[model samples]
Target: MFPKIHALCAAAACAVAASPAALAQQTLPAITITADPRADRGALTVPDTEQAIADIERIPGGVEVVPDTQFKNTPAQTVKDILERVPGVFAQPRYGDDARVSIRGSGLSRNYGNRGINMSMDGIPINTSDGLVDLFEIDPTAYRYVEVYKGANALRYGANSLGGAINFVTPTGRDAAPFEGRLDIGSFGYRKAQASTGAAGGPWDYFLTASAQSVDGYRDHSDGKEQRASGNLGYRFSADAETRFYLNLNRIRQRLPGEVTKDAALNTPQAADAEFERLDQQRNIDSLRLANKTMLRFGPATLEFGLFGVHRHVMHPIYQWLDYRVQDYGGFVRATDRRMIGGFHNEFAAGVKVHNGAIDTDQYINLTGGHKGNLAASMYDTSKNLSAYFENSFFIRPDLALVAGGQFQHAVREREDRYLSDGDQSGRRRYDNFSPKIGVLWDLDPDWQAYANISRSAEAPTFDANTFATPTSSDIEAQTATTYEVGTRGRRPGFTWDVSLYHARIENELQCLTTAPWSPCTIVNAGRTVHQGIELGAEFAVLESALATGDRVWFNANYAYNDFRFDGDPVYGDNRLPGVPVHILRAEVLYKLPGGFYAGPNVEWMPKSYYVDNANTETVDPYALLNFRVGLAPAKQGWTGYIEGRNLTDRRYIANAAAAGVATPASALFNPGSGRSIYAGARYTW
Candidate 1:
């Protein structure tokens, strides 16, 4: 099915490329349009946060921008903490920074690190060459804002993964405060200190931040500490060209708390497995990254290109002792022409990127903690990726446009076994995929827009996903999907909403099959599956009475209705794939008190229990959590403070579960959520 459709798209793209109309249009008179590249949407803008949100509303599809202020004044701990209340995003933390963050059911089968999702730092890919990405490298407070490109909307960022991409944009010296400092103390022995400085002189500018944090965690054997520093220096060559260099360094040391059974997870939620406690397993990392981005504008056209390098060292002791040193390098180039063509409005963008890396990896028997017994396995692993993509939108009218885009990706994975004493698992795999997308955006008026699109996405199995215990059965098939979606976004009379409905037909979903205890799981090419859902985000000015000139009450909400199931699989036979709940909702209500004081209550509710495995033999019950926060706005005074309370009801519930093929109900699969906690933070600005 995909082959035929892809062929059609390829032919159409060729035709469009050679069309006389397009050629003539491009040869037309070129007019230059220039403006500041900063996120600020000058003139027609409100506050910074509002401007960010407004930018998202202008996109034709599912996309969003989260303001830094939303979490900076609060206890910004982990990805889960940073992405709360964002619909279509499921970020559930089990321990420390290990969270299950999936969008649109992508990476639902992985209980560990992320996959099927592309992550970026200032538009640079954050995933390893083989798709091994660590959330701990992401400092929740380091970003000025976060941009979410859902699914195919990620074309601009060079991502074609099923889960799309997330870009963390940092603040620069242009408008940042000269100096800022913040301190946070919270329950579970949590504490952090952060400071940042920004300066600009002539054509040179720099922004830098340093942060240190530690947490005792809510569970036994779970403790962690991290130190991070990030900086960027920029130089402007005249007004039409600019270049920036970035540097980031991070060091993290975190313990591991093995999973517990359902009963234990709900009862003794704070207990760790006896084996994990004795081993004192830990995951530690030291990493350094450098990157650059350059943008040049020329008469209604722009060119952007960049290069990046990352060096990371990891020492982990869990099921086995592991050590790794990885070096990754990449570069990209993109060009955009937004001028009118053939007297009609047209926008075209094209780009290509290449990323390659190798890792020196070794595994040893865990003698307990950091001690290694003997060489168990050793290998040199390498991964390479190359992608070419293009997008062009033709305005059919002044208020509507038709968009076409696609990406071609080639990926290679290879392993060289050095430990023949155990077994020679050396092999290689190559994968190629062509993902294409088409859509239409129509303006209903000046304040509203409607859009519909269909796209194809593919995912190659990652090294972690191919960790087969049996070397003979190491080949895992890639996953593919065809998705159909429609959505709308608009604002009217103090109200804003973004909603979308989507359905996907998926083939060869990669699934984990744990056949033995104390052994690494193997990946399988699971049969057909279907993913369907609705995503809704809304904000309402509930109380804007004129009587209270300065007081206002606003409510914000995000909800997702997910229905994922097997599509006539031989074993599961239409049973729902386990892990994600049927309904997830997050909401908040805030009242502004004229004096720069604001208070809000937030709720995260999963109204339905979900199965834990393919067999659906066991389930996790529904849960609801309430949290409250009161804070003084940063603009209110030189010194501002906030107090936040989480899980006020202290409800016991499972936060995440590990899935097996169809194991016994007694398997250790559950991880408990954190208990009641309180955090207070203060910031000083000059």
Candidate 2:
């Protein structure tokens, strides 16, 4: 089936390439950066994060960027899929769109919530006061670019923590244009509509966007819907100074029918059992953000400062059995200075942040005598954190640069738990650490560069990890790591490629341990781990031929290899990292035909391995799948249509796994990736 689909797509692309209209559109345009907060000479070309990326790559670490064009090509539904395509980055999705991301083996023990990685949108931190972010709450369509800085390079953000940082940047008024909107409907009763408009008049500029999406889900009992709105307003005070205000709000409602057994997941990926009727769950997340940024020019130097605040609320009822509520509020401020010293240019950035939050939960059980009662298990945690960091990138020579930075963080966490008629259990913890990074970049030539660096970072425990009493410590101490890396990037006439290799050693690594009964467990920092890997990515215009009607053809591919493991640990016993695939490869060949016709076929392969279930039992498997798409658009004013088919092979495979000793016997939460599904849609843009 895969081969047949590939062949059909290939033939159609070939025919389109041979048409007369495609030849006129064969010439590819240079990429542009559209997400920067400041408007300057470089705004039309290099991205604001480009300097950040260069500094990170040169630091003894690894980093990657997924531009807007690359993300759009895949039609990504979630941030997880976007990260998986980046070299050396892994995303473990235990359920729909809820992801646990790890880079350089920094977040191996994150099972139930986000840890290690620090995620942010437009410079506003996303992690709760307890140091976790629910990735599902993010709307992928809202961001124009994503910057992933791994290892010590993340020190600039005061996130000297493990797993590094991910910055999602939204479009500014200048990039979005006057007005635009999109509407799409697809399989599983999926529907989505979004619109944005921005205008610049005099010294004031404003942009606003709203979007909504709903899906019946691929499996029984799993349906979801979401709505989001965001706006930005900026004013220029002077020729070189401007201030911008931002606002964002989101709401999500979902139903969890419950997980299926392994056999059921494999045999009937689309079927829902009758017993699932009794299972019901819903989650709601509401978030509000406000921020301001200003840029000032003094002499030959440019000074920038930003202040922001975030408030998030989570209300959830799981299985009608467990109810949970959480609220988080936080704020931060950052400042940076860019200037030329003597013959060298330098950029220095620093910031401080703090957060406070609380969580409360209740559990219920069905009594054997047909009686049902709820048990109160309430907990309150207050956390205050402060970090100050400075990063400087100095151009020692026209083609040579040196980068160095460090951060000092002070964090305190206090928690109190109250059980039904039981005395309160209270704990308080404090942590202070200094993280530093240094790197060098030698631009050997115009299109080629060599870089190297070494850096130190840390990761804190999550709320789940904080629940434990002993051995877990109060804050799980900070998980620390040292990373050494080198890499290169270049672009030739028809080829563009980037590759890097890194080695990292982590101490006090976090891992989950299951007790004998397997009904309850705790997270602890009890082990050491090592990660080494090579990431290679490239795109080549395999075939660029002009045919009738201005058609063109091209093919591209990317691959990544990761070697991660526990360093002679007693408990894990030579087990591979649970969610990180040793190898990942993606390839596609596309052609633009005349008369607005396009077609392509792509393949993604992951050789899987075993993962410890919630009960500490191992489950093993390996799988492969293929996908294809073709679309047509009549040459008209503003109307276009497209048809896409995913998982063309209809292969049955698990998309994610649960924590050790979490699921019942014979019950593994095997969230299957979508099967051979098809979607057709149309849009009108003016």
Most TM-score-accurate candidate: 1
- The count of residue-pair clashes in candidate 2 stands at 23
TM per candidate comes to 0.92, 0.85
Top candidate, metric lDDT: 1
Q: Give the lDDT of residue 27 in candidate 2.
A: 23
lDDT of each: 0.77, 0.62
lDDT string, candidate 1, 260-332, tens digits: 7888899899998777877778889999999999877776677889999999999988778889899999999
Which segments of model 1 are wrong by more than 4 Å?
1-58, 467-472, 513-519, 546-548, 634-637
What CA RMSD would candidate 1 show? 8.7
For candidate 1, the per-residue lDDT at 615 reads 90
List the lowest-lDDT window of 10 residues for candidate 1: 1-10
lDDT of 1 at 38: 37
